[model samples]
Target: MIRPSGRTDSRLLWPIAIHPFTGTVEVVFQHLKRSPPLDDEPLRRELMTKLNEIEGVDLAEAKLDLRPSFPVEVFAEHSEEICAVPEWFAHTVALAEARRMPDGDPGTY
Candidate 1:
């Protein structure tokens, strides 16, 4: 069983899940750890948009499905949504991450 903390933080985060074979992407927006979580669909979409733009190709927009977390005692976590990401979303994310890294970083060692 999966357990959630039911707590949130100021730093918003989302995990990008991709299908290795199908190339399908699903982003999970979770609650923060320092503060409480709110049903912030607009915030989620806004952040997602920034990431999606990296694809640089006109593709299908994300279809948000609002689903708040369940009971605290059971599963205390923010809701998640499944969206159709561009076919090149994965490559775009990789490029974006790589660009942020320096030409000489400890990870290179």
Candidate 2:
């Protein structure tokens, strides 16, 4: 949910997801429509190296996934391709809010 801002603030963004329990890190390549320099392996490796320097991050276990700019509603009726979740939009938003909510309950906090 982080956005980069700068003079060169291209619409491109890299969404990094870190799982607290399993320690799985995912980098979703959502802005493929825009030219992102990380598509280059060298740059990706360099960034991964820097990220791995942190105590808990392991670049080796990192997973790469794509989050297309297309609306989730469009994929709701899709039957051929298997979605990551049974319900994509609700599940995705719930997952995000769950991560944001410390006690797992947004209302309580």
Candidate 3:
């Protein structure tokens, strides 16, 4: 499940992964070469604002990972990044689930 940032009509959502050891939060966003790219600066600001609103999120250590979106038809190897704090991850997932589309479907083109 993913939440809308209300930044645009784009269906993309950010999934944050926190590194406790490094004290950093990584915002994972898909970068599709065929499509118009997401504006990173504004996105960083928006996400930072929401994250900092959390009781103990540290704003200074947030990072961005703009990874390429893999083709579904083509088999590819991938691994998910891990989050350090379970409660924070749960809260983020819940927020995403709440704003997600019904029937667990991604938005249509």
Candidate 4:
């Protein structure tokens, strides 16, 4: 699981999951009370591009899915630490480490 920073609104959250078997990635955008009026296609595209740039991974073979959700807002206060490092950044690091392996086998992990 990865948490990304940059959400100013306390009600907004983004979570991403990557499936190793099918190479499919799911991105979820959670809004507490309201949903964004616009689609998050640009952000998703940027993430896809970055992931595809990793060695040993074919972007063409990777599938990306976006999901949006709205949940009731119950919190009285917001925390600054709610957002964490973006998943893509960690994925890139992992990919780099995998490439350093003898056979570049990501499955070894």
Candidate 5:
């Protein structure tokens, strides 16, 4: 949400999200492009291996989209650049507002 000061909050819920599928151990689950990223395959493997050793559960049917995302919040406070990430929602919202339509025009939605 954009605040009264015109800055938008850009925090993600978590670093990563896990999904499970059918079968034994399918590695990982597919995530949307906008999801927060953990991006740790080796760590996941280690944890999964440990989990298997500890619980003896099969996890072969998983499909992982291990990815890393660099949020603008990391640099929001450090640099003069307000929105470092051009594609970020905050940045895009700002751009849209900048090009705002005139009142009673019913511009393309």
Candidate 6:
């Protein structure tokens, strides 16, 4: 789910990944737009609270990942750099991708 942060105009993208074996969930928050520095903590707290409200869910045990949107300069610097993917981003992508594949093995993928 993607929503605008009420505290600011910035948008937040929440991607959820579920572990088939353990039934564990992973939530990632990616900032889609830049906002004032002062709003960071409050915004994060708000997001966390909202996430906790999900039913049949364990927010505490869920793996949480937060990251900023890629800077425009990265694209100008290099073609591949256009995507400023963090190290953890790959893990999240892999998990998401695996979830979509036929007979996807969540435990090993």
Question: How many residue pairs clash per model?
Answer: 7, 0, 0, 0, 13, 0
> How high is the CA lDDT of each candidate model?
0.35, 0.39, 0.38, 0.36, 0.33, 0.37
Per-candidate TM-scores read 0.35, 0.35, 0.30, 0.29, 0.25, 0.29
Please identify model 5 stretches exceeding 4 Å from their true place. 1-29, 32-37, 61-109
Where in model 6 is the C-alpha error above 4 Å? 1-14, 29-39, 61-109
- Report the number of the highest-lDDT candidate: 2
Per-residue C-alpha lDDT of model 5 across residues 1-109, encoded as one tens digit per residue:
3344433223432223333332222223233222212223553444344333322333341433443222333333433332232234334333434454345232222
lDDT of 1 by residue, 34-62 (tens): 11221345545554564445432222343
Alpha-carbon deviation at 74 in model 3, angstroms: 37
Write the residue-wise lDDT of candidate 2 on 8-79 in tens digits. 122224434445565344545433223334444454455445444444444453332243122233233443
Worst 10 residues of 1 by lDDT: 70-79
Instruction: Give the per-residue lDDT of model 4 (tens digit) for 44-96.
Output: 55654544444332334233443421111211121121122254434533454
Model 2 Cα RMSD, Å?
A: 15.0
Task: Give one digit per residue, the lDDT tens place, for model 6 in 1-109.
Answer: 2223222211222333444565344444433223332124554444455444433333442323353222233234453422223223344444544554457554331
Better of 3 and 5 by lDDT: 3
Which window of 10 residues has the lowest lDDT sum in candidate 4? 70-79
Per-residue lDDT of 9 in model 3: 33
Q: Which segments of model 3 are wrong by more than 4 Å?
A: 1-13, 18-25, 29-37, 61-109
Q: What shift in Å separates residue 38 of candidate 6 from its native position after superposition?
A: 12
